[model samples]
Target: MPSTWTTTPVTAGLVHGALELEHTANGILPHRLPARARAQNTDGQLAMAESQPSGVRLVFRTRATAVELDTLPTKRIYVGAPPRPDGLYDLLVDGHPAGQAVATGGNTLTIDMSTGTVEHGTGPVATLRFTGLSGEDKTVEIWLPHNETTELVALRTDAPVEPAPASGRRTWLHHGSSISHGSDAASPTGTWPARAAALGGVDLVNLGFGGSALLDPFVARAIRDTPADLISVKIGINLVNADLMRLRAFAPAVHGFLDTVRDGHPTTPLLVVSPILCPLHEDTPGPTAYDFSHLAEGRLLFTATGDPEERAAGKLTLGVIRDELRRIVTRRAADDPNLHQLDGRDLYGEPDHAELPLPDRLHPDAATHRRIGERFAAHAFTAGGPFGDGTG
Candidate 1:
């Protein structure tokens, strides 16, 4: 029997997040930032992560057993370095994990960082299909890759598709580093934020950028302007890793970031979380160094190279940043009762580390992402937590 296929435009209404959408020559590129936010900085790290579609997902409804999506992903490759991991798209049917896929068609951007050179080549587009659905009207969610930039081309289903109705759940707007960006996670939906959203029953807008979460003013403004019932900002690591600021500058920057967000969400429940335990960086300062010794073996790892003595000279460390953040939130909460703080250690601490070690000496593994997400839900989204309902 022949079936009619309906094509959907992949518009903003069908997407859960992405601060802005760019109409690329081939398709629509979902950006984690708006034009104004994007215009402020032209840094390479920001550009890459902003377009990775970390927390972005395609959500819709249809009574079709089969569906297809076309995408043009811009996968990055570093010359003479470990191969880049493939981007994954996780599909959920009626809120349950149903399938997974990777886009095959796209262009490749190669960079020779050792010499500061680059090249680009075109590739074919990929058509991802999902079948065996029950044909009853159902909600479908396709989570895009968190590490690769993708341009959505088209969405086709056996039956007509429409924007899924809002789930009526509270909106959770979260910002953090790569770990929160789903780094090293097996699938997009397996990212900690995605898992937490599932457990908390909230709509998620992830602004997690791999190495770009340095307290940028533009990022604060983006968060300021976004509408969210609950908000969280995972601070520390990036600043330390980049060696961007000193203890003197860190405090004011933290205040400024919070100030920008408070400008818009004055009364919304806001949570500030510090960095989890990273043994190598606990007391050591960083402009961390890459452990390239295993690069030839097709493995990548990171290590701290900064001196621990630098702390006396105002260098920042995860340990120092954590204490400062807790102090900042506590002082602010004195007057603003809605403000709160959570020790990220509680999510991925020494005990958890004993059982599940960090593979890269940084980002959590798939199982840890799940454990952290579940812990976050219990601590921050369950009854009596900051995002808790009024009943508790």
Candidate 2:
């Protein structure tokens, strides 16, 4: 710890990236969804993703040379996998990537899907520290691990830390699946949404929930209530993978989702993006299943297990979802000029996929993330684009 440093509580007002904070006896746990919104959540997948804090960060102003955070992370471990990687904490000074960290100790949750059981292992909290910060008062953003569930205990700094002044940048609120949550991105800033936020010159509030982007009403409510100059929803991928709804339920669901968001952000630029090219699920319906064929080789893969014929019964594939989304957006745009649609393939298509195939047969690699972010900024935010100021 820095000599004679002051400590600060991890309060709701201090955290920028998280939607809500779960104040516990040990520390404050950041939640991507608020209590009212989370109350409707029953799916374990959504529950897990909400607690991961992908784009959530702690933003404050400080002149400290050194800072430390006591955190207890709930790290998940699959029963058969060798071991998961440590979650990273990416730090930014005045919006520039500066440092990175990883907490050491916390409770470990092990799960064996084959047995449908979970084992919780308790451990001590670990303090992550960073030093040599520039002396000038500067805005600092501590991006939490995108893949880990972290409980922030306390913050210590050589100098007092206060909420960072708003950048006065337009807030871009984005919602998507795992790709948007940064499944394979190198760091928090490396995520496509973060990269796009940088390129688009906007503030980011990423609501990208991994497997939870199933067009849930609560998610739509959250998006509707949040203040955003520009709003985007990267739909379809999670829908196809989860096979949560069929054609009949999907169209109405999409309509309802957008309607709910429009209730609050009637005029905000809303971009509805389809799924990126995932050949595995383009034609095949899914409830994507794990392919442990080469477990010994330490290579895990996923496959769409649902039959293509199921589409006739209203089962959704990426292609089906994309077509439906386009139809819905075009129809809606006829009435609402603020609504727009962007094909996900434009960001990551055939050529890009060949060079940077989704390493997991799902999530794009880190480099691919950069490509997506850059493309998104060009397609959505640049002049003459859907979200360009000229549109208004």
Write model 1 residue lDDT over 121-201, tens digit each, in one string. 899888998888878999998999988899899998888889999888899999999989989888888899998988898
Any runs in candidate 1 off by more than 4 Å, and if so which? 1-3, 390-392
* Candidate 2 lDDT over residue span 1-392, tens digit each: 45698898777667886778888878998888888898998888788888898888899999998989999998888877768788999989987888999998799999885677888899989899999989999988899998899999989999999987777778888999999998989988899999998888887888998887999999999988888899999998888887788899999999999999999999888999999999999999999988888678887789889999998999999999999999999999999998999999999999998898988799898899999999999998888787776432
Which one wins on lDDT?
A: 1
**Residue 251 miss distance in model 2 (angstroms):** 0.6
> What's the distance in Å from true for residue 340, model 2?
0.6
Q: Which residue runs does candidate 2 get wrong by more than 4 Å?
A: 390-392
Clashing pairs in 2: none
Give per-model TM-scores. 0.97, 0.97
Q: Give the deviation of candidate 1 from the true structure as CA RMSD.
A: 1.5
- Cα RMSD of all models vs. native, in order, equals 1.5, 1.7
